[model samples]
Target: MSDSILFNVIPYAAALVTLAGGIARLTAKEPAAPPSPWTPAGRTVLAGASIVLFLHLVGLAAPRAMQVFNASPARLFTLESLGLIGALLLSWGLLTLGLRRAREGQWGAAVAFALVLSQVLTGVYVAVALRWASAWYLHVTVPYLRSLMSFQPDATLLQAAPLVIQVHVLASIALLGAAPFLRFGRVPARTPASVEPGLLATPREETP
Candidate 1:
């Protein structure tokens, strides 16, 4: 079906972005910079954000774990509660971080935070609007993931999903692709190099 084809292609496109971004990071250099001053509040916010990111990924890993654990309704409900908590943490963490960055004149950082908030809000909406989506997600996504891992993606499982869910999937793919380039998981900054006036000149230009 066309829907399934789109799902399959979108992941690869997102992957391309991630791969390209990573390669660009690896080959690029940065200017020398002094170490940033860290404060207790900054550390707390960072730790919270890290935890929220991990909590978001937990759902992806949970299905296998749950299968092994023989997941029940009670356990599923607990997971649902945990998802809500993660969403709350994400919302709070992002809002505070965005405000702090904006106050410090870091408009770019503030904007990035706002962009991330959209994703978090989408997830929160799903958690609320789509009843038992977490449980259903396992049945749909886990298999699709397993298939992809084996180099054979089967998007048919999710073809019948609502439009919002499809959009969510695409957004997740974009996030995965972009995360490598973003501050959350970016590579170390390389030392900057000075370029001479004729550094890039050809043989004719080097004559003087």
Candidate 2:
């Protein structure tokens, strides 16, 4: 019962919240302002996050291909190494962002940063502790996520996974649920090559 609630029920609930909140955010009227610029840390975070998200999506989209890709020992190690590097980069950016937010007295945003950082840390731990993450992810996480997408939630795929992995998955879902409500401030426009690093501060205006 508990497993069903946690894996099956919670994911759907979070998805609903994310869907509704996203629509509301899109439909709301707000004055447009000049796009702010991305800070160095923000760029770092975006780059790292994009890499990690891309890999995950690729795996989910082509589990069979990923399995074949990981069949070689060298290839598997290389893939895992890239994942760890991305995680490290993400951690570095989050640490910078969180500290800046704290210094600015944006406690809410800082707290959100902490939650996200924890999620990232847990993923790093999973990658390190559970060898061959990409291979196993295809077996466990991908199927489960696909199940959720197909409206056939199967908690069993995760029931046997390590507790940390389970926590990481659930925490990610929680973040998705809370995404719309998190007012972390507007992301600045893309930093141009000519922009001085010193001038690339986050926008002062917080998004409602």
Candidate 3:
């Protein structure tokens, strides 16, 4: 396969693995006092998500590099935007896992999850907004500003598209991060509360 195809496929596979593992854990029978922080299910999802997230970062950075090397503006914008969306979603998934762990009283694990999640969310927004601004700088705003350089422009209108994009990206990331945690972390401990005599009683045969 081509390098480009491999690059895209890797992240997708990682995401699928993470999602599958997470779903499995959610459906599995709850253990008393929550599963170990390093349980098989937890580790699988965490590792998968981390791999996917790293791939996403690489994907986002590539477009910026292409732009620096004089790649087509349209293609740059499209690639960057898609990368931003992917990164946002990955970060969101991570944060959600952290929140869920916290709710289950796994504070340390939750904190670690949250730290990475928050960083990814913040970075994705900032990077996407900057990328959008760069697009406007090369496309519309810079040209307009140059035209008005001689005349005193009454008011300046900067592109709000980038800011809006940033907000939406951040929101999306946060939501995705919160989803799994909310779904799985809320599961109560699966302790055997009480043993009833009836449950243990053997069936008795009736005599005529």
Q: Extract clashing residue pairs from model 1.
A: none
Report the lDDT tens digits of candidate 2 across residue range 106-149.
88888888888999999898888887778667898999999999
Evaluated with lDDT, which candidate comes out highest?
2
The parts of candidate 2 lying over 4 Å away from their true place are 186-208
Instruction: Order the candidates by lDDT, highest first.
Output: 2, 1, 3
Per-residue CA lDDT of candidate 3, range 1-208, in tens?
A: 6433322233344445558767977798976574443544455455545654554444344545644643677766665555566555666666666767887797866766665566556546555545553454334333333333434321123324445443433333344444444334334445787987788898899999
Question: What C-alpha lDDT values do all the predictions have?
Answer: 0.68, 0.87, 0.51
Whole-structure CA lDDT of model 1: 0.68
Across 17-55, the per-residue lDDT of candidate 1 in tens digits comes to 888888888788966456656544456556656755564
What candidate 1 gets wrong by more than 4 Å, as runs, is 1-5, 32-64, 67-70, 181-208
Positional deviation of residue 66's Cα in model 3 after best superposition, in angstroms: 4.8
Off by over 4 Å in 3: 1-70, 132-197, 200-202, 206-208
Instruction: Give the lowest summed-lDDT range of ten residues in model 2.
Output: 183-192
